[model samples]
Target: MALTTLFPPESTATPFATFATETAATPFATFALSSTEAAATPSSTIAPYATALNGVNQPMNILFRNAIWWGLGVLAMLILIIRLMQRAIAHSRHTAAMGLSGEAQAYWSKNRYSTWWKFKRHMLYAPLGKKRHNREIRLSSAGNIGTIPSRFHAILLTIFFLSNLAFLAFLDYSRSDRYSVLADLRGRSGVLAIINMIALIIFAGRNNPLIPLLQISFDTYNLMHRWVGRVVVLEVVLHTMAWAIVKHAATGWSGIWHMVGTNPFISWGTVGTVALVLILILSLSPIRHAFYETFLAVHIILAFIAILGTWIHCEVAKLPQLAIIKAVFILWLLERVARMARLGYLNYSLKGKAWTSATVTAMPGGASRVTLHLPRHVNVKPGSHAYIRFAGIKYWESHPFSIAWVEHKPIHEETLPRQEKETPVEKQLREPETTTDISFVIHAQTGMTKTLYEKATQCQPRQLTLNAAFEGPYGGHHSLDSYGHVVLFAGSSGITHQIPFVQHLIQGYNDGTVATRRITLIWIIRESEHLEWVREWMDLVLKMPKRREILQVKLYVTRPKNPRDIISPSSTVQMSAGRPKIGYILREEVKAQMGAMCVTVCGPGGLADNVREVVREVQDVSVVDFIEESFTW
Candidate 1:
């Protein structure tokens, strides 16, 4: 009945085929048991190996399989649901704030198809679609929240990272002369260490959630991460030590390395051990990592080398399984390279000028602005940012800068490369532009901005060449739609991100698309030197007839000796004191603006953190209503 039968089924075969010929009767027709089998019968002989399972092994295989299933199935599903709910909450808050009633928002949310629409928008970055398809989707859902990475990623990585912990713990237990530690335990520990090491590398190479968290705060997680690393290093040490001790008790240290190096199972592991030790040394101070930038570069290069060594150590057998493990790293590397390529192309080719040039102009306080001129049309929204690199002076590394605004700019046309199936006319429109221009406001610090500030003050606005790369229009302040008044608080260089937002809000009011809420800008600078950068923009905005109806600007300089020294608009809400804490404002000023008021703050980390804490303490509102960008690394 089957299309092809390569072999006969066991159920249909004769019973004699199940037994070995040697174990059967000598004569095929005779029924007689062999002497060896008769002696080994349960009533005749006792068994020894049958006790090993209950004696030592704990049925780990069955337990581990069950754990894995529960983790991958039930846990993963819950995480997926959590991600969906978070996004739904954010969307509902946004829509409801636009004057929609709770029932109406609920009705919109009830549509199950909208979840699929959201999923499509989030996953547009996946390479399943053609170039034209991607372009169309990018246009349609321009401001959708990108993707929230799957939480199962964190769960799986935690399992692997913890597995390494278990192996290390076992190794330590065996080494401590504890009753639980024995020869068999040592052997099991070594095997588990090897298995966990291989698994850690595999999980790590797949862009695990832990990687991004590490990049952001190495210190917070470094203790646990380092403990695991030390364990792996120690396992290699103990594995070698255990074998060497046995051999040395018989032959001494003369043949230790030779015996260890000759073993195919551990030869590559020996090399990997040396590499890990070297890495541990370099990771410490006096060698490097004291400097942040240099530390990051060296750390990345050494980490890759360490991972390579680990892979080589595991692949001694040259098995297909090991080859597949190595291939995962190769694929991950390729994906990262692809991401870099896409980012580079987007940055280098903006409109047609090849690069944007800027000149640093001093502001009233310690702040400075670098004005940029574009060769052609380029469009970026208020919250959008571009990575900018200036000519000469450490321009090799580009840093992110929020787009202030373009005085005159055109609507950008979305361009797509012509497909093989497209008509020729469509191809003409898709031809790439040669260049474009953009500007960035640099908040002077110790490194790149320090150099820029010196150049700006010492010389003319030099004809600088810079490479511009764009990343996102990711976040915006709470819109003015629901709020009766919008209050924006920015400190020093923080205004670069906030100023454009205010402009966008004012325009929203002017267009009458949303409520004409009052707009208040509070800017705090340590000194008068930084105010020069915004002097022109503040003048222009104040002069506008449309802005006159709603906008108010307040500037506070902490070092002001007299009231006249402050460079702020007329009728400013000037305060004289030490730095103003958000908590103070919440207790004193927020009561009057409590209802239908949305507060947005973007500043240095300390101020931003304070604002968030204050808001949480004072208001019982959803997280969607209060937005803060600290720009903390």
Candidate 2:
């Protein structure tokens, strides 16, 4: 019997049986049905079969979604528990060491409990390769291709990728018609794609609530965003291909093309798929790094188009996946709104003071020191950065710059002029005059930075002041106050990030509020002239009372003009002609370790990797923690 003869187009009695018979003739033809034909076809017979299919699919979708949420919750819970346990341990050790002499303190440091220390050392903190965690794999001096993921990150990404694959291939085909099975596969892929979009949007946001709750860095979230975006693109491509295959098999190439041209559902879906493919293409590491601003602008535009197309496609198709799309859209909207609010609040002055202004001063080695004079006080801390926009230069562009220094100057009534002090209104207002000066030392690497440097150099005294606006004081809340020993490593311009930590920790030590007993700052620069970048700040830190007792500064001139120029200023402030041996320094620090040690690095990829490796190697011998500050997006 002819397969089509057994199940005529007019039949409506048994939809599954009919579909089975028709599909049996040419299983590929199942997807070729035109929209008109599909609409004209009887639906009553297929309703029961679809309900049966849903019995399997609905639960699977629910399970997968719940699994993602539960996974995040569990991870967050584990981090919280670990933090509490560490605090408890620190308190216990502090109490025990309070009465101990130097020898007893040393003994206690060596004998402290460390059940999870080994696991963290070998698995959590360990790099994919030995000692290369934050270092980028550069294609050349001008281009950094990427960096290796930590072992812990690698494991999580693997599980996430595999889970997505499992969900994509989970459709059952037992006793089901080929047409029905193919349709089920298409639906599953589409549903999964929509679901993954939630994660894609969440991780892309700067104000992602999960960051603080889970203690994950923005760099890690950026990594997750890229991977999740790739997965979403893959699922979208699969979903589109499945539909195309079925359509082409059912009718012909012409019929499928005709449907796409005439059918809103097919046309909108095709548009979204095309946009997503373009996003994947333009987001390659090389292309993204080469034309970051252009890439970012286009990426945002294309992403919006893709989302709008998908929303419309779902609406016209009446797919249940619209709920997921709605959720993703809401998240994207919320992030944008929050970002705008932050910018407005941070930049606008309401107290009749002038708007923020930035003074750009050219420095040696193509770098600029930008000082932002703010109208109000800002809570400045170590490790903080801000996104700054220059209204007179490039109003549309905002770049992240680390806060290198923050100064607060108080206004005294006695310092006011005699005429102003005589005013009755001025006399009634006795509040202290306070202003904040936030500064960033930015290296001229590309676009806006290069322009800023050029403009600064053109001015007399190589400095220019311009109107500007800035958002944040973001990041920098990572605490090093609990550790007794702290080691900071900075390379070239990366000193901007580490300087604040040095200042904050030293102040804490002076106030007797922190557990820190020792601090070592290692700064590596290309030329000896680069030392002038933080000269004033370093002088202030050096002059602090009791600084010599607790602080040690090491300067490494990697490419000095004259090797003899690299001279040690003092015993505590040492200078070297080449890179310091990171491993050797770490080992020595570990030998004389205090209660606990914290190793931090914000430098070139090579330095970060070296520091990471050294920390991992000595983790088992001491209670050590590593924190790396990087902007990898």
Candidate 3:
């Protein structure tokens, strides 16, 4: 009675004796405990009946026992049938191979071996390459396609599931006499459960260090970061549920309350649970997440709370490891914050002190270009970008621009006189070791570029006091090493980024530093005039030997001028009338030139999406050969 109340109460309890004795109501009851005992009692009438074999109970028991035998019998038959089918298929293949010519047979055998090696090689190398290709393998820690950071984590999860099953089996075997099943949670394996929980946390916390590596793209990276937090939340919920079930069966509902209050681990668990629930509610499709600015703020707060809870949950003893994790995330956060602060300060200080003049020239088809004048000896790099602040805009955050030109220091010939007293300022005026004219193509997009175009065309000889704070040279666009071919995919306005990359490729090829066999440039855009913005790039690609010898150019125009336009040269200079399909572009157009070929793509949303699609499709492509760069943050 006490045991009954501890579980669910005596009223709900089903007695085995009661079940066995009610034989008139149910036939199964005759074999139940009470009925069988009564039949076995040594009364004259029952003793004779017990010895007799002709009875309904005998038939019923036999039928019940034979049901298990029938099930196992069917399973064996099914397995035998599958084996025969596989053998038959193998026989057909052998029969066909017997008729092949000697040379053909040898070639097929060699090809088969080569195929096996290729498949095996990819499996071995996939993880090493996954580090470089960061985005593809990033999955939610809860249960997304099983990201394996440590081989140990994967093995642990498998062991956890199996061990729990075994424990459940043990519980069932122990209770076979009573026909009672032990609950899943009561049978949970402690070590395996702990291992699974730890692995889940490790995978969730893996991103604490990756922020800095993805610098200047906070908006993009934050999306993934926030979602990872979401996954962490889900994992914690499951962890809590597992504990809930275990506590309930062992000591009833009161035990749930007792376990929750007494456990130190539960304190952290509660914090994590609350934060996750709040975040999930706020992030619902109908709520504040719909507003980008508000969502960003709330997301950051929730992230902090969740991480704080995680830190406590892992226990204060692991602070050193936790600090290392936190350090990586904090360092990157500090860097972005510091840079933004520096830019803001410069914009204010340099506003009146620098009375600089600038020019804005209108290009064909509604695009305009602007150049800012600084005190002349300002250092800049060809590929480096800066945050630009123009006059008359307060609270308009600085926009990113590539350096177009910088003053070059003069070098003296042997015949010329050498000057003394080269002051620190004079030395500072000297050109950078690797210097080139700074340039960037401005696309008329909806944001800052559109504002720039409107203001520049309207103003006359504008006395613009521009303050620029540089943020990069973050990406290594031209760092081509150990590659035989260079392929660049640039969408409309993405040419600014790709042109410098291609130019570097051509220079490297001519200098013999690069052994690139081919340099193919594919540009996707809407207007032909947009090509004029990067005509210098087009001309260079056309003239370069590496480009001409191995380089091929394909231009795709989604919106063409005439109805007769085709993608090939014979028609309107456009490769295709519709948007370029990534699958088609890579397989039919790019794959022949794919081996040891590096693919770099940059552009708008559509272009980035297309490039991502291609990259995903070619999951088997060598990681060294694929590079994706997005110019916009």
Q: Quote the RMSD, in angstroms, for model 2.
A: 6.7
Q: By lDDT, who's the top model here?
A: 2
The CA lDDT of each predicted structure is: 0.46, 0.75, 0.44
Candidate 3 error regions (>4 Å)? 1-224, 235-438, 442-449, 461-465, 536-552, 562-595, 604-624, 630-633
lDDT of model 1, residue 215: 25
Q: In order, what is each prediction's RMSD in angstroms?
A: 14.7, 6.7, 17.9
Ranking by lDDT: 2, 1, 3
lDDT of 3 by residue, 487-509 (tens): 67777766666666566556665
Model 2 ranges with Cα > 4 A deviation: 1-56, 87-108, 111-115, 411-433
Worst 10 residues of 3 by lDDT: 46-55
lDDT of 1 by residue, 491-517 (tens): 777787777777766666665544435
Cα lDDT for residue 531, candidate 2: 82
Top-scoring candidate (TM-score): 2
**Model 2 alpha-carbon miss at residue 207, Å:** 0.8
How far out, in Å, is residue 358 in model 2?
0.3
Rank by TM-score (best first): 2, 1, 3
- What is the Cα-based lDDT of residue 241 in candidate 2? 73
Q: Give the TM-score of candidate 2.
A: 0.86
